[model samples]
Target: MVAVRDYKTALEYVQTFEEKDGLSAEQLMDSSVRGGLTYNDFLILPGKIEYPSSTVTLTTKLTRNITLNAPLVSSPMDTVTESEMAIHMALLGGIGIIHHNCSPEDQAEMVKKVKTYENGFINSPFVIGPNTTVAEARGLKEELGFSGYPVTETGDLSGKLLGLITSRDIQFVEDDTLLVSQLMSKNPVTAKHGITLLEGNEILKETKKGKLLIVDDEGKLISMLSRADLMKNQNYPLASKSATTKQLLCGAAIGTIEADKYRLQLLVEAGLDVVVIDSSQGNSIYQLDMIKHIKENYPKLEIIAGNVVTREQAASLIAAGADALRIGMGSGSICITQEVMACGRPQGTAVYQVSKFANEFGVPTMADGGVQNIGHIVKAIALGASTVMMGGMLAGTTEAPGEYFFRDGQRLKMYRGMGSIDAMKKTDKKANASTSRYFSESDKVLVAQGVSGSVVDKGSIKKFLPYLYNGLQHSCQDIGVISTAILRQEVDNGNVRFEFRTASAQLEGGINNLHSYEKRLHD
Candidate 1:
């Protein structure tokens, strides 16, 4: 019998040029002496495009142990990430870190929600009691954005199975007080709780039902599988999931304080796949001790430590067993850390220096902050970061935590940095995420390192992420690299080129001469 290799393994190694058109990554970093370069300070030189953008692969590692189909991560900000954002981020081939600005129990609940969110099944689905009125069900439908719900004895997953309620039952009910038990479909088909997704799909197809409830031997509800979710599984081919559990990977942020030890324990129990040791400056002893403690206790958990901008900081975290490093300081769009503290390297330079050093220790780095568009993402990869952590770029999306409001006839959502006063004030005083991040919780006075603002509404992650993914693919294709791995290799080999953009060149590259125009990214 003949053996065949997978398509990824069979892919041919593309050629690279010896005589490059512009400065190499190393040269660019070295030449940036007076002040480090930002994304806008330089531009990547395009390579020969030989294949369609759709053919470009973007699989990369977020850490030494965790790999993602896409090199994207949502920042752990109060207004940017929550259970909703984390779930969608994982389903779209990336991960979101749940912010720790809230109570530990609340944060843990958010992590649990992401872990329990199955691709074809709702593990901890919304449930209603038999006595629930038609009006209440309609209100729930509007809140949850779903029409069908499993009806249980006690209105929750812990109760015994009763029946199922759907939009069809309450659509035209004249009486607002009509009970769910009266209109729910009786004797619904269900399977044992431990059935595989394939088996559930088969049962749903055979029974011609829209949902398949999983229950225990005593007829207690365990989960609900939906046909819509099955369709979504087919649609999202690049979803990031764990191989062993077949669940979407989830992450959460935690401070480096003594109290956070308990927070980490709760998060770990909730099936957290990764933990980011969130800090504005990550080189202190607190973070080092926290990293060592976590490594010793939870050997299986991957840790991404830092908001560091130097090689020295990366070395310390890597020594303390960090699997990945977050490289950026004072570079976030809403952050003013450099101005307030007068201590931070330029983002482009910071990413290059730390990522290069971390690579020596077999550690990946996340370029956090200052990512404005798809081009910036490509630039970070070229500079050696394996993934990019987005804050302002991803804020204002439908999934991001916050309600959208109209301002000046434009829809907008709140976006605030963790170090912003508003965010600090919103956090629990005993467990303030902002003060802990800046290592100033014990200070007599509170200081702000970031600002609060709002961003134009950017619709849903379902629509927004695909645009980013395709844009990244097209960018890699233009750079003549078929995969993210090769993109880094080409940059290292000086095959991919870069050039410093003058101020005039920056203006020239944009819509300079256009009188006025509406910029639409995706429909």
Candidate 2:
């Protein structure tokens, strides 16, 4: 069975004039590329990792403080951007733009979820004097949800940090009465205040530890680094840079009719980055008035206005001091604003128009819907969208809150639309054109459409994020763009080509007529 020639030579020998003249891609339908089908004839997209390698900075400068890793964002939908999802996204280095389809308190809980998942705050981390007991450390971890403690010489950390104690370091002790000093990690790796993050990473990697202690000039314990803190913005993992500001950035969705000031203030205190003044019909006096009020009072807080579909609407929000814009008009899978009332633009075109104008004023635009997969993400980025807001796709995940229940022999989460019937009380939340107005006075409960519902399987965002990250990396690798900025540049510079496709061709190729290999390894 040994071959006399290599693959290239063997292929040349196997080629027959009959095969070339008589066959097409359609004829082979198996292993060949078939008739003029080039990689350019179809679009391969980027996921989260394949960022442009040209060193174009992608820092989401918010409130002069917090910076995110990837500019890519998950949409704030009822079933998508929840507490679990937010924390995982943050862990994976992207931001989970939490949805606000629920009550104000619930939304606040979502914020707390991200900050609390794993953190190193100025206050309230596990702290203990050098002479504490291992039993005490174990108790602290079990009860308070903190797994380890920073050991300082004085209770106030005024002296040098003596060492550190973790549950694993203490678990095998013969005596529960053993002192923490007996088991503590002594003279643990420490970082000076001005050290680079890259240097910090190396120290952590060398020591094989979760965090490092930050010390002042005199070796006074200044702060602690949580393992979670060290892992952020995975896309553009930083070597190191000191954050001059302490502000945390978050995005919120507010109603145009009754966005409460008290709630707004609470969000500002909770580290809200931008306020998305959400509305079905955003070009009205009601939304404009709300924008004016927010700008007047919370002058320092960044406000992003939207659901706007045109240049004029985008213009109005921009003029009202919008820090960013959300562009889409009835593109949502569950939205019926356009169908029932006959208003709104095609989302693709809407993104183009709004993003074009919004970019002119330095306000970033988020393409809000119609993102069924990673391709939509790439397309939105190419069309000048600063980011994408996904809902249905990201839903049913751990960060997306829900209890799993049996449905059609599978576990799933409740995934539904906002303007959906569940969102509408059969009466009040119901849409009435008399209640619905497009460019004028209107009604129809205007929302009354089919109460269609779908169920999705519940899972954690951790697994899902890696899929996106790898997918984006492979996409960029194929296109020869190492970064998102570069990919966009290639697309804009005509270095990219787009090809529309149908399901048949996509599925027809690859190993066919193979055995089913019916076997269950795990199940």
Candidate 3:
């Protein structure tokens, strides 16, 4: 029983001098048992909002040299990413890593396809000689999946332009041996090189022709345009492209084996923009040697190394001249590396520690795994990762490299890890055991680090990615930051606070009372 004035003074003093309500990222992490934590184990404390969500910017770096409008990346898993997925990811302001589970030639061709998908001018259009048979033209169409071919006198791109052959020219012709010259449209509409696509499109509309050939001053065919492509004009405003060629930027994955060097040569020739050295444990001597060798030989190429969790592993790769670091180990949803090998750190702790270490050296870091939702992505970035590399999150999209099938009343796409037994057993001769991504040990003993699974179809990435980007923007607004860079700065300065969630708190935070509910990810 104390006096009222004394009690009031004590209450005021306690209120004024109490410890800060929330923990800084470092403090929260240090308090964890052995510094181990996962994404869902903690929550970011909301801050006072000074701006609207729409005004928040999400731009961030993907590598030391490459910047992305959106800080998302698709994983380099065979069942997840390919040319289609890469193209869409780039268009949506992110980048995709093409898997190396196929032959070098096949992978190189995929890279070429992405680079040549859309261009201001077609520098290398298909050409046929005057003597080329109608059947041969049809075969070319079937193989290359294009119906229009420019007819040149010398059957080469440098030859003088003669005519153009289209599917209409051979629709009624039954003779397979008929020469293209006999049926092609002679003196077809032509546009000189250096004409804008708009000008070419106008000329095409006025001529009402299916094909428009762009020729040099000497009348040699240099490029071609199609009315179909113009009508279906797809514009990727956020697309990443080469500064010189204006071709789309693409990345591919490779192992540290000797054959990978030759494969990398082919990929570089195909105009690969970046290479991800695929390995579960990237601190190995083999990976370090490969990183050094590639940096010495291809000095201009950018290399992203690691699937490492600790600061030492990151230091080794960064010292070896890695342009970017991929941080994570055994934290992916489908991963079993920790259980099987009894190694690897929890994803949240790994990302925070490795990114903090790598940022000091001016190298960007990617949160490589354990991104199950948009909240996870926000947490990854808030932890100092420059970008979040997703696997299962992007695996079920329509652009992903797989067909959908129905099972248990749900449409799902196949998703598997590179080290899964099913993936290791794939019959691609070029993808031998040495290139079995996560497992580079003895070929005879199959030690799996992941599993084979399927994910529910999430529709197209066009919708899904926009939802994710908007979610991130809203998150930044809630965090009272106006951009990703600002968020990172605040996090590093300890201005951004966080709190660990107890088991009961997590349960209360989720929708627990509902007996049944239909979940909607986007509004």
Best by TM-score: 3
What is the alpha-carbon RMSD of candidate 3 to the true structure? 4.4
Question: If scored against the real structure, what TM-score would every candidate get?
Answer: 0.84, 0.67, 0.87
Taking the tens digit of each residue's C-alpha lDDT, what string does model 3 give over 1-523?
A: 9645666577567668445459888887883453588998999999889988988888888889988889988998888889999888887878889888888898899988887776545667878899999899989989998888888989999999999888999989999999999999998999888888779889988999878899989999988877765554455566666666556678999988888899999999988999999998999998998998888889988999998999999999999999999998888888898999999999999999999899999999999989988899999999989999999999999999989999999999999877787778775452553234665445656777789999999999989999999999999898889999999999888888899998898898888888899999985
RMSD after CA superposition, every candidate: 7.3, 10.0, 4.4
Residue 46 displacement in candidate 1 (angstroms): 1.5
Worst 10 residues of 3 by lDDT: 427-436
Off by over 4 Å in 2: 1-71, 101-106, 116-139, 150-165, 168-211, 214-222, 227-250, 257-259, 289-301, 424-452, 458-460, 469-523
What lDDT would each prediction earn against the true structure? 0.90, 0.60, 0.86
Model 2 worst lDDT window (10 residues):
432-441
lDDT of 2 by residue, 63-153 (tens): 2233455555666656566666665665565666666555566677667655544443332344688777777777877887766677878
What does candidate 1 score on TM?
0.84
Ranking by TM-score: 3, 1, 2
- How far is 257's C-alpha from truth in model 3 (Å)? 0.9
Candidate ranking under lDDT, highest first, comes to 1, 3, 2
Q: List candidate 3 segments past 4 Å from native.
A: 1-21, 31-34, 50-52, 133-143, 163-217, 224-234, 428-436, 439-441
